[model samples]
Target: MGVDQNSIWNLHNKLPSFPTLNKNEQTEVLIVGGGITGLLTAYELINIGLKVMVIDASTLCSGTTGRTTAKISAQHGILYDSIIQSSGVEQARQYYTAAMDGKDRILNILEELKMDIDIEQKDSVIYTEYDENIQAIEDEFRAYDTLNIPGKYTETTELPVETKAAVTMFHQAQFDPLLYIKQIIDVSIKQGLEVYEHTQAIDIEHGNEIKVTTDKGHEIHCTYVVQATHFPFFDPLGMFTTRLIPERSFIYAGKNENPHLKGMHLSNDTPARSIRTAKINNEHAILIGGEGYVVGKNKSSADPYKQLKQTAYTLFPDHTFISQWSAQDYNTMDSIPYIGRLKNKYENIFVATGFKKWGMTTSATAAVLIKDLIQKRQNPNENLFSPSRFELTSSVPTFVKQNSHVATQLIKGKVSDEGKSIDELKANDATTLFKKGKKLGVYKDEQEVVHVVDTTCTHLGCEVEWNTYDLTWDCPCHGSRYTYTGKVIEGPAKKHLKKEEL
Candidate 1:
């Protein structure tokens, strides 16, 4: 069965279109992303009477924000146990507190605005059906208990499948992010917030005042800047490229009659599967998500989505498939997000990133924490999530391993150019070839047209791989994605891939 690549966000109202920054502008705070994180930060600051402006390289919600599974829970897959092991019990407790604060913030906004947004209060559970995995689940529950995090371990859950053990955090939530983000953008606009879509922030100039240079040759002058973009585009001294590791996960949603699944669920088993229920046209539906892999690992696939369907049908016999989408999330060297000043020197520049696929809760947390930092308010969670806080014990190994993988990918990308000759290439597909040792990416459009671009990623000097599913050339090194025709789609790379002559 052919499935379309649309996410299941049925937005009822048309969102306002923002313009490009054709001329220079100034604001008190310049937020350099338009996703959930950037917009939420704008809403938070603007409500407090700050002159804020947000800018995005592409259109709003066109990135990973549009493709989320919408799980608004802090149950980050047996996280507390690991957090306690890596950091301490206190740090684990702090993490949990911050996540709860984020969840409460979302609900508070919903209540204050009286917006429907299709939110539901459901228990978030992490369970394992395998006997070998039951111990880990038990340990996670114990960690929850030790931290006084109200959760329970049980053999039975709302899952249709059998579970040996499950850890449940009751009253966690899920909602349509598209709906919530629209309200965030709209409400912020009402408070004199300015947003520019399709305006990529290529570079930033540091001084007493921050000057953000855009692709359109216009600048945004502000006292402070926030790198709320998914992968920050401008990182000169932060070493973010070496520290951030990107992974992609796929999610499929299907129609169901009176969905049997009630609570948001994630399996602790190997090759995890997450299940949740949502409203589609006011009717019940189930979303099956999992099958995660490193960004450049799946250049060629034997169809993971079909495998997901097999798993879904085996568990829930009543599901009728409708739509599927994928999201890319970054993991920090440590598990926590970076949600404060970017650096000691660049104190005026703040950042919010590394959500680890749990952005639904963490994004709101980042927004509020950023507001506190900007206003110089005493926030309890401020130092806990700082960008420069380095946990060397936990982060060093991951940093080494992540960058080693990157170095290997960079080497492999430069060497592996064994694509079919132009005669064998097909329409709506892409491949990389070399001429005179210059690597070139080639694509054939549906209209029988040819396009080519330099296959090197503009962010770092790594080569790119073709993604047949998305019809783009994706960088395996730092998760920079480009259209088959060479336009930048996602970044740590702000510049477009150089177009090549056919």
Candidate 2:
């Protein structure tokens, strides 16, 4: 069978379709993204008799929402220990509470819909393959204990490997994410949600009212706006780009006589190891994820998917690679996600992102928090996740580290060695070369057709590096991704990379 390059969730499910915006329209709420977060928020407001419209750059839920391993749990690696130390115990408890609330909301929806999507209640575990990481696990478990969370510390887990120690959170769940999204779309549409696909919200003009301009020149005038795009595509304060860090992780899924994970398991090791199973349409596949790297940090010839697959079989022995894909997620400067309103000035515009790869649980909470904000209700957790509330101590170090690395990447990309000229470029490969001091990316197709684009990242003038694994040009600075043809895929960069003159 040919390996599918998309998330295993895409199989046997077709999402409800919507049209591209053709003309200016008005609504009470305008959601710029049609993914899980946006849709959940839309459903909440629409159910309360508010006019809500959702727009997506491409198909709904086609971004990070579709590409997840779909572990709907509150356990996000060894996170609580750091959060408790950085913030307070109350703040840490609030974070845990919000995550659990989000997880419960997902389950409640599934029960209300009574749909079967291979939902399984399983314990979620964090283990360490190395001795160095065991202390981190012990600290996290202690944090969990202090927070009154249901968890236990152990010396090892159920995975077929040697481990220093582990931590387990009981009764977390997993399912086919896309299937659940399909049901959410159904429930949302019934609540009178207007959705627009292939309609990109490009610019936001905030005056007496908020007006969102799309790529098609159509505008959405609304009382409130929500930027639910994985990264805030429109940042007025220029804060999000600096505050958020993007990383990419790979997943390999296939059939095995015995799946490695009895429960969803993650190793607390660098570059991480995540394992889960997806049983859909009576077909069972074990998914092994995590050979990850920060965007544009290590751009070389090696493929992450191959490494993940090789690692899978070495551990599972009977692992068969049926499908493979990659997912990109953003981590905030602090451990907590930046939910709630975008800024004090733009109070009418709310934003929810920086899930830290735990969106299945976090996105649901974000939706509810955004709804409370819109309805003028006070949510206790609002201040904790506010995008504008920057903790100097927790965030400043990350901020300095991220921007310094950005500085290094920006300067490094300019002075680095020029790659092979167009004639010397290999078929079905890509490179960056300098011609007349103009850095350009060159890609030769299977048919030997040469395509070139200016390697300058449109977001902040940083250089774009060729990512062989995803076959896209990635900005080492802020995680803007583009096609070999130079079309914008993921962004902080809204514009397509300019084609070079060759």
Candidate 3:
């Protein structure tokens, strides 16, 4: 299944195209990703009188930032109690403060730039259906109160489904992320920051001056490099491979009752549902999201599209269905994003990733932290999310569990072949039929060109499913995506699948 168009936030709006890097370039700061983190970091640095350049494998916002739920909130699903219990009261408090202040900073930027990004302050809520989790919810609320965070506890919710209890945080927000990013990109360009699309940074050598080589043969020499690629492109120093795991989530959008719910909402339980609204061409649209799982795992026996449609109908029977889409996110084992310096082993290189589905707020927070570090300023939240911090207790177990799951999937997928022909495929259609003992992906585009790629996801060897809406091969387990020709369009899969000879 592919992403639904209606749920996409203001993507129809046009922005200037960024030229691809074709020659050698030098800058004071080189940002190796053009998503929210990279663009915002460049925007901030340019304002502070630093020469900045941003390079992307594809276009801006085409990565996880473009596919996010776009909720800007301090309330990250049932985390305060867990963090306070595990990391101590001060650490949890600092985390909450950083996230809350990040939301404020977004609003401030919107106002300062007078950008119309559909920014709205709606209370954020986290609810759960299981009554057994009510005590956990209450405990989280108590922790919030103890930290003096502006939040409240409630036993009832406005959701179509019933819930045991919910924790509401005031002054949280939702917005059209693309619009916000467009404004920032424009400002960055005006401030003399350079952005290059279709520029894939293939290698990075760290020193007093960082050297970045692009697939297109362009070279970048810079005093500093920031890897905002969601998962660090360079993993040797950060151990991002061991620290973070990728997950996939689905979203469905359609028209709903007049102002369905007043605020943005998410659940505190597994298979979580998130709700938010947007105005598309003067019409209101509702986005309901759930059905998440780790990469490569098939949670449903039925078709994902049918499942999403049925779920939406169950929640809003009278509303008209518009569009549906899915997004991939990286979840850190410790629930904190890895920000600041890359690691103790590498200097002059930095990274910001592992937002755990809260990238909208956390990405902004990362920009602030990275910008501070680049310009030699100070930020209190830097150490809390530092990449060097190691929790061996949790890290070891997480590493084992993740790798074991991957190995299991890889071994289980070595089955026999059953081929299907391109003549039988329909437009915007895909299938995982076998061809000559090799599992092959078959996708027919709107133009009727048949695309053939290996069905195996380059990340973790999970079988890739056809997402008809997005016209990409989607890894059901970890949310990695590839162009029909087997190009690595998304990651934690940094490498593309080897193209199978037809």
lDDT of each: 0.84, 0.85, 0.78
Candidate 3, residues 1-502, lDDT tens digits: the string is 3333433653555657878898999999999998888887887778788999999998888777877788899998888888888778898899998998788878888888898657777999988899888898899899989898887899888887888999999888888788788899887787798889999888887666778999888789998899988878777653776567777777878886666577898887766778887766677777788777776565555555566677677767787977677777888878788898865547678899889888877887888898888767889988899888877654567777876766665665556323446677778776666667778777777788777788777766777766544567766545678877778878867678667755
- The total number of steric clashes, by the backbone 3 Å criterion, in model 1 comes to 0
Candidate 1 C-alpha lDDT tens digits along 141-185: 999999998889999787667889999997799987888888887
- Pairs of residues at least 3 apart in sequence or in different chains that clash in candidate 1: none
- Which window of ten consecutive residues has the lowest lDDT sum in model 2? 1-10
How do the residues 383-425 of candidate 2 rate in per-residue lDDT, one tens digit apiece?
9898888688788888999999999999999988455667777
Worst 10 residues of 1 by lDDT: 1-10
Model with the higher lDDT, candidate 1 or 3? 1
TM-score winner among the candidates?
2
Better-scoring candidate (lDDT), 2 or 3: 2
In order of appearance, the predictions have TM-scores of: 0.95, 0.96, 0.89
